[model samples]
Target: MYCDESGFTGNDLLDQGSTYFAYASVAINHEEATEYVNNIIQKYKLQGGELKGRNLLKSTKGKKVIAEILSTFKDRIKVGVYHKKFNLACKFYEYIFEPPLSEKSSLFYQIKFHRFISNILYLDFVCRSEEAEKIFSDFQNLMRKKPNYLFSSSETPDMSPLDDIKTFCIHHRDTINQELNSLQGTDIGKWILELSTSALFSILCDWGKEFNQLKVFCDVSKPLKENKELFDVWIGIKDKIYFDFFQGVEEPITFNLSQEVQFVESDKFPGIQIADVAAAACAYAFKEGVNQNTESWIEHIPGMVIGKSVIPDESYTDPNTLDATRNLILLRYLAEKSINKQPLLDGIEEFLSAVTHDLNLNPSNRIATIAENSRSDAPYFNF
Candidate 1:
């Protein structure tokens, strides 16, 4: 499979109206992708650069490029998306850094330790400067259907800025770090980012077991070496980090999650380039209130979509594959994962519980929120 990501930054996770983070994988071979690329180049009549969804989604011709590329790999694509909750970043930050640099707080969260710092971050990130304010204002305007969108809300629409934010953070973590140093070292930001980026592939890992081996190609992102390390750790840590959350699991689920991971410039690899286009299309579909691919986006990923398990021990067996379905019960699947890993979850379940419960994405009603008296010993801090 050729895999590529659209948005993933160390900081933009808190913005609900961002790309959040999205990864797309296609089962098509490089040769096939290459054939499609050639057809697109000829059809579009000359393109010096490789095709990308970001570039293509702009012009009418570009949209066709996205459509054509997706059509070539229809039924072979799988995508995972997230409009990360900023609170989620705090939770992850708290969880990763031992004796967190400072206490973590949310005006909307219950924690009291670092309330001051939390407020500072919010102001700096959301309202600090003119550019930031303008960006945020534009984002708010984009969310016309949802009022006072807190972003982490369970109901309503949001604007996604994950791609831009993530890309920005990757390039400017040091600069942002100087201002937000109270939250442990900037490394926490990077690790949290690793989780979001890698987490996107949980389904891919579950489904790859059906095949003998998997080779993944992705477009280059900032700090190539570090992104490579993050990707590797992400692939290996799933079972280590999430196995205990499952019910029947003893030893972690074992499989060759990936045999080879190659990061190439988008234009250099037609396969990775098309994967980019597919990812962007999924993000557009998701951000536009279309949870799953529809309209011009369904040309890809039209085949069986594997099921997602809400708990820890559950694995995607070959039988779980179903017709292409979006929304794939994302809220429950992620919330349960967060809930089950409570000790490492930064003890902030109020918002987690609210979003997870309100979404009601779980079919079995097995997801027990804190409100339901599902108890844990962690010291939660969300408002």
Candidate 2:
């Protein structure tokens, strides 16, 4: 597979102009990729040293070329797109919640909490909740290892950012709190915070599952190169990276990559160049939506997506959507799976029901007041 990325801001996900990050892997070998690019260039009669996505997006004809390219290669390409802020909120959920909850009830953690909690937190973030901002800020501060930094809850009781979700942390404060306090000092904490790193790992795993012996060629990236050894160890020996968190309750998963990813110049590789176009098209279309001319190219993208779309369709917390109702039901299921923990189970059911019923895209005056009080001194929208 050939890989390339667009809208990569490394660790600076929030401040970047690109609101979405995209990484694409094309399942075409070098010989076929070369022939395809050469044919397209001749057919379009374009001037080019390298068929860069940015340059192709500059003209009407170039866009048509992109459209044709996507139409022809749609089945072979897989693109992962993430809204930067939403992605950050997901990281926050994983870091703060996963450590404790995954340990307690692996089945529930795998089945529900990861998706449900992250979606809930994402809703809180886009709705402009003050607590979401504070939590996100604390996570950023923690990852960056700012001196004398403390979680918001440490200074003020009942003031930590999760709002309703904080109930679980409170119950398991000994374990959860220890993780929060010490995670910044660890390497995994720092690594998990990088969106590119996460996307790369996910997409590679996706490819690995599909093919038995895989060879991945990527555009030159320092971050991927730095993490190469770590990736190999994790992909080669899963137990080395993560405990058998699921155990026999869940089926074993495997990642197969025969050799280390070879980083090469995009100019020399046709496959990486095509992947560049796919990634760029996805990043732009998802971030800004589509115009009249580019809509054809955009239409073909969803089929190529491996999981969720670039932006989620439902406001996860709004009761008007079935998504909220589904989350409520999931909480009840969590209560079922939870072992002999009445208080925690009750808290889960109560918190999710209340939050789902109360939250909306637009907050009420009272909700706004809570938001105003909960936010950090700096504005949440700025990032």
Candidate 3:
């Protein structure tokens, strides 16, 4: 099953807006899925590690260890790392409230670092597509094997009656929040949320079907309401695609979310693929800026761009461009840190100029001139 989330983090107080959204997805077949849950019990040997029991990580140290082990295998883990970097950068500027290098009270001089490491990691993974294919092949093989094969005879019965293929798209908000509430620091919460988002994205890519045939089932929660803007953007995009794809058909495969989890016996709702949609959501979040109805931007941005370079294409919007743009704004806030501010300003000007050229913006000269004029405090200009 795939799992993902949006708006886990509260708004950015410094910017008076949220700077990050996170999502995670995971995928597993029936046998592997059963084994995964069962292994949690067997590995930890918990008193009540039965399938229906709530085996939270806090209950036991062994359980925590087991949870971490399982988390490493999740698809969204890398994406989680990226989100963590962004969150850390935000905290460094806001919560840490570190004084500016040169100025004691000038908050405007504080660095606003834009964390795009997650995108770089994603691009690296996709560039190494062969590895993904190999891992997926191994997963399928493992799924087909008998459940008992991985366990001793004493533990074999625990995995029996695992024939039914069930997929659940669980948002980790409640669990993470519960864990964080007991903790003393904000860093762990940031990391946990990042991990959850990455895992959700991974699940989506593995279990999700083609965009033409996809449905999402979710539990009603506050985060959903908080992130309604993002959802709306994505749904709007999906609707346009659906209309285009089924122009001649009387009815087309529609994408919608339902709170109801019930499905008829014959009904085969494809397993949840949270990472696929989470990646799409992240793409949209970056494109539309952090706001409600950000999901509408998802339709305009192609899913083909997932795990690809940040350079924009007619088919795929470059999330890197958006990230870079955000970073430029942040850099302006950091400009006062430089001993030679002119050189720093020049670098920023050159980078923005290149981007404008690449975007084919008409009146690029006018924009560059404005950027040039924005550089007023050049030390050499004193002569």
TM-score to native of every candidate shown: 0.50, 0.73, 0.29
Q: Residue 4 in candidate 1 has what lDDT? A: 78
Model 1 CA lDDT for position 89: 30
Give Cα distance to truth, residue 105, candidate 3, Å.
Answer: 29
Candidate 1 residues 278-338, lDDT tens each? Answer: 7777667655643333456554543423233111111121112210011122222323443
Q: Which runs in model 3 stand beyond 4 Å of their true positions?
A: 4-9, 12-23, 29-39, 47-79, 82-85, 88-212, 217-220, 232-383
154: Cα error in model 2, Å:
7.7
Q: Compared with the true structure, what per-residue lDDT tens digits does model 2 show for residues 20-74?
A: 8888889998999999998898999979657788788889988998899899999
lDDT of 3 by residue, 1-383 (tens): 33334444432211224333444334344455345555655776655433211123124443343334334443322232123323333332322122222133232232112122222222322345332233223322322231222112222111100100000001112332243344434333324222332333333332323333233333233333333443343332334222222224332223333222222111121122223334334533463553434432333223323341122121111222433333333343333323123322335446645655654453444334324322232211111
- Which window of ten consecutive residues has the lowest lDDT sum in model 2? 374-383
Flag regions of model 1 displaced more than 4 Å.
15-19, 86-189, 194-196, 200-204, 227-254, 257-260, 290-294, 298-383
Whichever of 1 and 2 has more lDDT, that candidate is 2
Clashes of 1: 27
The number of clashing residue pairs in model 2 is: 0
Task: List the candidate numbers ranked by lDDT, top first.
Answer: 2, 1, 3
Ranking by TM-score: 2, 1, 3
Q: lDDT per model, in order?
A: 0.45, 0.65, 0.31
